[model samples]
Target: MPLAGPVALLAVPLGLVAFRGCSTCWVIGPTQTISSGRLERTCANGVCTLMKAGAAASPAATP
Candidate 1:
């Protein structure tokens, strides 16, 4: 049909836009997991340090 050419032309641009948008979406999954894990570990370390420091200081302040 004569309409097939124009329809294909439109599909190409739409497909390209969709592909470009989704291309980076896959990368977020692994990176997000790794970064979140790193953040949690960093937060845990910070909390542990604070707790140790507070405990150490409490004994000195008591007497």
Candidate 2:
């Protein structure tokens, strides 16, 4: 008897629900280049935030 089969059946629907909930909260727009680097626009709950490309490009090295 394999438990993975039953587990996956129950988990797939739950995963879809989680993804849909996340998508509703934030919406990301295309990236734009500036003098420094690039930037991404993110809108969440009707408020927008700018994300710098350089920072995201090398996240692991930053403190």
Candidate 3:
């Protein structure tokens, strides 16, 4: 039998969220860290920072 790729991927993320719900604090791209403890997705220069709750600058995102 073959494994379902989509299901497997989804399961991994879900499992992470479930197991490490609190410690897992990050995003995949640049972000504007809000005071409310949330990461806003954005791109800056050439790298994306999974910013904390309060990032210092709002650098421009590269295309």
In order, the Cα lDDT scores of the candidates are 0.58, 0.60, 0.60
Which tens-of-lDDT digit does each residue in 1-63 have in candidate 1?
A: 999999999897788777776656667987877666333221343564323322333333455
Per-residue error (Å), model 2, residue 13: 1.2
What lDDT tens digits, residue by residue, belong to model 2 across residues 1-63? 599999999997788788775543343322112233566676666978778754543333456
Of models 1 and 2, which has the larger lDDT?
2
**How well does model 1 score by local distance difference test?**
0.58
> What clash pairs does model 3 have?
43-61
RMSD, each candidate, Å? Answer: 12.8, 13.9, 13.2
lDDT of 3 by residue, 1-63 (tens): 257887797798778778775433555222324344575444656877666546677655799
Worst lDDT run of 10 residues, candidate 1, spans 49-58
Return the clash pairs for model 1, or none.
Answer: none
